[model samples]
Target: MDVADLAALETGGSLWTWHRGLRDGTAVVFDLDGVLSDAASRQHHLKGPRPDWEAFFAASGDDPLINEVATVLHLLAPELIVVLLTARPARVRTATLGWLDRHQLRWDLLVMRKDGDRRPARHFKQEAVRGVRERGMDVALCFEDDLRNVEMFRSEGIPTLYVHSGYYD
Candidate 1:
């Protein structure tokens, strides 16, 4: 997504709520599905040629918490701004928010894909990180499950930790 397109996308959460954290000059980014949440149960819907995206995302509410990553999130959130950047469409914001709450996950900002956006996850996510940087918040680190996204961020000089969930291979 381009600058204008990105600006048009719906972003949840309040940056102001975590503005103090940003003063430290860095933010930590976390991807939703397959990273913070185990998306294995919903992976089936993404199989075959015409993947049932709606079904895949619709079933996300049932995803189990990825405890290890959650522990890391909890550890960093109190010191650094935590941004939840996901390729999930904004249409599922309510369910997504509920899922976060259910897991007791706290994030300063939530960035979701624009509805009907057909861009690849790598493209969408890279732009989201760029947007975060554009706000003067340096991304100190990122946690992602997709290999493509991990490589993308690393290529851009952003430190990204790959959490394997077997989604990309």
Candidate 2:
């Protein structure tokens, strides 16, 4: 999904929210599934688990629009700290990192759900991201595909770019 797709998720939020209220030395967060990887493009029936299809979920291609965003960030937004915030399980970390490396997407920090943590995605992200912001690491923006997460983030005053995902397709 591209800028227009992000715009489509908006309910009158500023399209250029990235520039508004951003301070120097802030962190920018990117959601992996719909924002960086092609997980959103691939057909997904049931999300959350598939013990038999671990490999399929572990390794995947990049979403075209997000791939371009990575390049733009690498060059123009190098000053801002980059973060990859994924709800994927911890078991997929190695494969996920490999994909990120291949795409040359820089992530200063990576966060994932650990094994046996069964909290809902919205709750998990809300707590984790809130912790980061509370620690004084200013979060300038978040690129996400899940509506549940977008609502939580925006409610906390963090600007979000909502990308279209197969979950809603």
Candidate 3:
């Protein structure tokens, strides 16, 4: 599929592109919220009824970097295609970019959920992984905090390392 088709398939709504073009090779995927950016402070907003997603994401810019994860990302970026895949919606792209810049985390590609698309994280990320693979890249490994996502990726034959961020508990 072409870029347009890939974008739509990945996002499920309007197209969103980053500065980098698709790279074909071994790719290591990382989940943003819990894995890279420590969203523990803002995860409270997701509790209770009517999960205030806006508030949770709006405060994303202030999320501190997961030092160890950031280090791993930096170490692997120069050698492998680092793909930052997040369940966070795409509307906060600017905030996400700023957060990454502030933390100095580098990634070859960042995939986010489309606005208005509220599928569970596992499903969305699974599709994102497929999209990445379809672009001729092999998803060799993934680092994710969500157990559901970890299971999904492993089920798809991708090796995954699960990090416990305490958000799912």
- Each candidate: how many clashes? 0, 0, 0
The segments of candidate 1 whose C-alpha lies over 4 angstroms from its true place after superposition are 1-24
Instruction: Please list the C-alpha lDDT of all candidates, in the order they appear.
Output: 0.78, 0.63, 0.80
Better of 1 and 2 by TM-score: 1
Better of 2 and 3 by TM-score: 3
lDDT per residue as tens, model 2, 1-169: 1222211111111111112132335888888776677664454535456633344454454444366556656775567867667677666655665676577666666667665566777787887687567646789999898999999999989999887865655
lDDT, candidate 3, residue 100?
73
lDDT of 1 by residue, 1-169 (tens): 1122122234322112231133435789899888899999889888989899999999999899999999988877465778888888888876887787778777766778787878898888877788778777889899998888999999989989999999878
Scored by TM-score, the top model is 3
Candidate 3 lDDT over residue span 1-169, tens digit each: 1233232234443233443555679989889889988899998899997899999999999988899988887777476888888878888977887777667667767788888887788888878788888878899999999899999999999999999999988
Off by over 4 Å in 3: 1-16
Best lDDT among the predictions, by candidate number? 3
